[model samples]
Target: MIHFPEIQSEIQFLTKINEVELHILREDQIYPSISGNKFRKLKYNLEEFSKGNYDAILTFGGAYSNHISATAAAGKEFNTPTIGIIRGEELSEKIAENPTLSFAQKAGMKLKFISREQYRNKSNPEFLEKLKSEFGNIYILPEGGTNELAIKGCEEILNENTREFNYIACAVGTAGTISGIVKSSENQQIILGFPALKDSGFLSDEINRFTNRSNFKLIKDYHFGGYAKVNNELLEFINDFKRQFGVTLDAVYTGKMMFGIFQLIQNGFFPKGTKILAVHTGGIQGNEGMNRKLKHANKTTII
Candidate 1:
């Protein structure tokens, strides 16, 4: 019920140096749930479904994936059946085991699983063939819920407020969203990406293949650890961020990139007083369990 429109430009940063301000995209501020770049990407993906009748929309996600949750919400919104191909096999587990997964199931999404290795080959012919044979005529969504069509929706995030900054920064995962942001971004604003995956070793190639261009750079060292992994420093920053800004930070993706941004600023990457914008792509649903544990840990420490 957190209306993001009201939170527009709500996340302001007064850096310790020169008191420079960095604005946060916090696109998820409006919905928190089913908000963020997911809503943007799905707005168009499901628009055609509005006209045509389909049995279901099939997408991929990890055990606790924001994309899966958003896809379920979109399916519910559009009155379409959704099937989530989760990456691991835990279908028989109790709902109490994983709330985010349960929420997706409650949204009426059927869950399927492939091995970790098979998941790596999810988009390959053998996998799609197996899915098509099993599910029959279902629409396929790429892992991380990113696709070329998703770009059209993702780019719209910057439309209303353009040319407001000299640079734009976002956390990149599958590169679809970042590539789209880079393409539609004002040429004047330098778009930079801090990846949440280790080394992002192949990230530049992934973006080029996704966007068919070679105009971007990837800052790979920001991952801290591999995707969905975190460490002590991130938790410290998340706590300090809450104390300072009153906004909770999730560990996996946004926190790492945010930590990277602050470090980059300290390292003097951006010119003094340069205007910069950072996108707070949301995935709070995945954090509910992690936060609970973290809070207990924090309390235990205080005790």
Candidate 2:
């Protein structure tokens, strides 16, 4: 049996924001690679994989996907060979330029590159069949690893320690994490999801597949132009947050969510004495790659 390590979740207070007392659920401190929602999302997936007699595990991700990095680390520790089908065919030859891909490769994940057109067909029967033919019989984990099992794992994110918060907030990606949060939350706790992407219309349906509750909301204004897109304001906020709170948030997810939380508090969105909890979904490793991109664009880097 594979022994998965336990992660410590703690609460940190942000003091005041328009008389609102903010708390942070430091999910990022879970582990270096398998941290935050990635660890929560994979907890049960790995167990299911181990139960089956699968030879290797295959998953999908982009050039800087936190999911890709975490899966590679999990495969390494669990002694399972892993394959990452990365988007953007051109990245196949430029692995060195990408920190996330380089880390995955070093962790022993075999890399495959396909065009964005083909990647869009990743769920098609024929496309999956082709992958099986090439990689052999393998356990397939979806991009972001957001299946039913993943939501089950994520449900564990909230526990007795978090029951005091009136509102729980998290950065949304594939919606699996927030869906689990919504299902596991108390009846009075309102869950707020800050999407890191532009078009999150599909998240409502995807989340509904696993949850029947309407206790959650998706805030879309904080995306900062879309996925992977950043600006000087975000960089300043991330660096300032690191200095002030001693937590480094990735520009893609956690940073954006925190920014939105602060904005809402300042705009008088929350009640005066509302107690809010924001989740820190870790993806700090990808910050190096993001910093490199910012440098290339001649913009300020995230510390």
Candidate 3:
């Protein structure tokens, strides 16, 4: 079995003038690379991989995907080769400029860049056959590493300490983490999800496929344009947040969730006496790549 230390999250109360108490579950402190929800999602997956005879593992992701980076780091730790089927073929020659891809490569993940159309066919039988022929027998992980096993791992995120909160909130990515949390949450506790992508209403159905719990709300107003897209207001919040709390949030996932949580508080979405627990799903490593893009666009960079 792959060993993972039990992480005890520290709860820091939000400094606000309301009667409601807001606290952050520091999931980012779980591990350096496999920190936050990634650690939970990958725990069982890596253990399963360790028992398999597959020589390599293949997974899908975009330029700064946390799943891709975590898989590469896991492969390196377990002495298994990894193959990353990257989203954009144009990123092939720009590896040097892409921090995420470069990190994967240095961690020994052999990258295979494909067109957006091809990437969409990642799970197609023909695509799997073609990849198997080229890379030999391999264990495949879905995009974002979200699966039944992954959700099972995420179910352990909350414990006795979190049961008292009126609402538990997190950023929804592939919906696995939220699914796990909803499944484990008490019937009286509300699970709120803040999607970092626009038009993510589809996540409701996707999350339902994992568990039948209805004690949840998908708050969709927080996405800053779309996935991986950010503006100055969001950038300023991220920077100011770090300075205030000393916790660096990734612009893509956790930052958006935090932004939404604060906005919701200010907008009176929650009752005055409501006690909220906001999860900090770590993806801070992607900040480097995001900063590169920001610099290229002449936009304010995220810290």
Candidate 4:
């Protein structure tokens, strides 16, 4: 596993109204090669595989998945062959042309794709058996890199963060990062999730894939539009946040939570003078994907 240097800071936002405290937990500080939530989630998947004496690592992701990128980096760092099972049939026709797929291949990893329906059964035993038949003995990790062992490693992130926080918030795509923080922290802290997508009742199912119970709520309205989708408000907030705090907020994940936090504060959801800790789950590399999805958001205005 690639170990990143510790990065924790008390950031003061120079807002037009007043300063907001965004306790930045720099997962990026971990390592540029394998940083962010992807690293946290995959760390223990690797651990589990090693403990089991597995030959290689096999996992899932999309075109611009941080999980895939980090898995490639980690597998390479650990001297393990990695296989990426991507989504969609477009991969079959022109597999190498896809930038992410290409990068996965170039990184000494193999990239393969299946039908959308097949992708649904990725967690099923039969599909896993099929994978084993083809690749020989290998380790299995779920998509979004969410697994029980992964969440266990994620807990360490919060333990190492030296900040006294009243509320801890994070952008939840798979709920692993949020769950890790909630299950690891003291009872005095409350965890909140800002989903980056729409219609996320299925997120509960994903949570069940990890632990039985957790202290967290998914604030669904902040999605702006949906996963990878963004609006003018989100973009404006991104611009303003960068201008104000000298920190970059990507539209896919952190941008959604940052804007949602502001709106929540305005709506009297997060009261003033409360210490709020925001986990910057780094998917900043996916900002290019965000640019594409923003075009479909329908309400266009200057960011």
Candidate 5:
């Protein structure tokens, strides 16, 4: 088995609102490159890869995908070759301008840029066969790296220390992280998922596929537009949050979840004396790319 660094996530108290206590589980500090849920999601997958005869690990992701960055970093750290099927063909020439893709390239990941239409068929068997023919002996990981092994890895995020909380909250992307949390959560602890995408009603079904538990709820109001979309309000909140708590949240996921959690607190969504533990599933590296976009658009950037 491949050895992994010990997880050092800590539950830190944030503040109390309306007699409700809010705490943050700092999974973001797990590892620099492979941070937060990405680290958990990739832990067992990399172990499985270590035991396999595959020549390279091939995965799919967008230009600013934290998965792509983390996978590239993991491949480099483990001395294994990696291939990244990037979503936009236009990004081929713009790699120098994009921080995430540039980091991936520097980490020794061979990037293959494809059109948006082609990217949509990334899971298609025919398309996968074409990739296999091109890159021999590749072990394929899904777009967000949310396979069964990934879920199993995520299950380790929650422990006895987390049991005291009345509610567990996390930023949901592929639903794999929340599913694992729900599986390991105490019976009375309600797991709240804040999706980073708009119209994420389908995430319920995705979470259900992994666990039969109905104690989880997807709070759909926090997406703040959709995946990778951010507004000035969200950016200000992220900046203010960092200034106040010294915790940096990525605009795409954690920032929105934290924003929603604060809103929910003010709205009396949680009963009095409720203890909420919000999991900080990290993707802070993407903030640089997001800030670049904000700079170009003349909008507020995350601090």
Candidate 6:
């Protein structure tokens, strides 16, 4: 049996902003490697794998994908074989220089790199059939690990301790985490999602597909550039935030969300006396790889 650690993420109070009680749901503390929403998203999937007759677990991700890192760690801990279908073919030869890919490879995840065009066809029937042929009896987890089971696992993120909050904020990637948050949220609470990608308006449709609720809103201005893209301001905010709160926010997700949350608060987005809970959906593992890129470009790195 695959035993999951009990869901006991601490709700930490950050500070008061315009009379809004700003707090953070520290999902990042759930584990050392497979922390935050990654743990929630992968829980049931791994459990199903443990129960089933599968030869290996396969998933897709970019070079610095948190899903890839978390899935690799989980596969290692659970003693299951894993295969990572990486998006960039060029990265195959550069794995030694990439921390995320190197960690996944060290965790026994077979790495398969594909061109961007081929990766775009990942959900295509023919592409899936070819993958099945290449890796027999493999259980495939979608890119970002967002599926029905993942949504179900994410529903557990909110519980009695979080019921009193007036707003819940989380970083939106594939929309699975917020969908589960929207599902389990009280009717009076508003769920806010900060997308890390530009032109991410379609995420509303994605979230609606999982749940029929309408209490959530997407804050679209904080993406900076796009997925995995960060600016010096963001990097500085991340470093300053860590200095102030002692909480490290990953650049890809939580950092952007927290930055947006602070900006919204300054703009008086929330009513005075409202309670806001921001979910720290961890992606800190990607920092080392990101810093490597930044250092290569002679740019600022996350501390």
Any idea what lDDT model 4 has? 0.74
User: Compared with the true structure, what per-residue lDDT tens digits does model 1 show for residues 74-137?
Assistant: 7766568999988877543645577777888888889887678878878898878888888887
Tell me the TM-score of model 2.
Answer: 0.98
Predictions in order: lDDT: 0.73, 0.91, 0.89, 0.74, 0.93, 0.93
The Cα error of candidate 1 at residue 70, in Å, is 0.8
For 163-215, candidate 2 gives per-residue lDDT tens digits of 99999999999999999999999999999999999988899898899999999
Runs of candidate 1 with Cα error greater than 4 angstroms are: 1-16, 212-215, 292-303
How many backbone clashes are present in model 1? 3
Candidate 2: clashing residue pairs, number: 0
Q: lDDT tens string, model 3, 194-245?
A: 9988989799998999999899999998889989878899999999998998
Displacement of residue 99 (Cα, Å) in model 4 is 3.5
* TM-score versus the correct structure, for each prediction: 0.88, 0.98, 0.96, 0.86, 0.98, 0.98
Write candidate 6's Cα lDDT for 118-186 as tens digits: 999988889998999999988999999999999999999999999999999999999999999999999
Over 4 Å off in model 3, which ranges? none
TM-score (C-alpha, index-matched) for candidate 6: 0.98
Model 6: ten consecutive residues of lowest lDDT: 1-10
RMSD of 4: 3.3
**Candidate 6 local accuracy as lDDT?**
0.93
For candidate 3, the TM-score is 0.96
Which runs of model 6 end up more than 4 angstroms from their true locations? none
- Cα RMSD of all models vs. native, in order, equals 3.8, 1.0, 1.3, 3.3, 0.9, 0.9
Order of candidates by TM-score, top first? 5, 6, 2, 3, 1, 4
Selected candidate, larger lDDT, 2 vs 3: 2
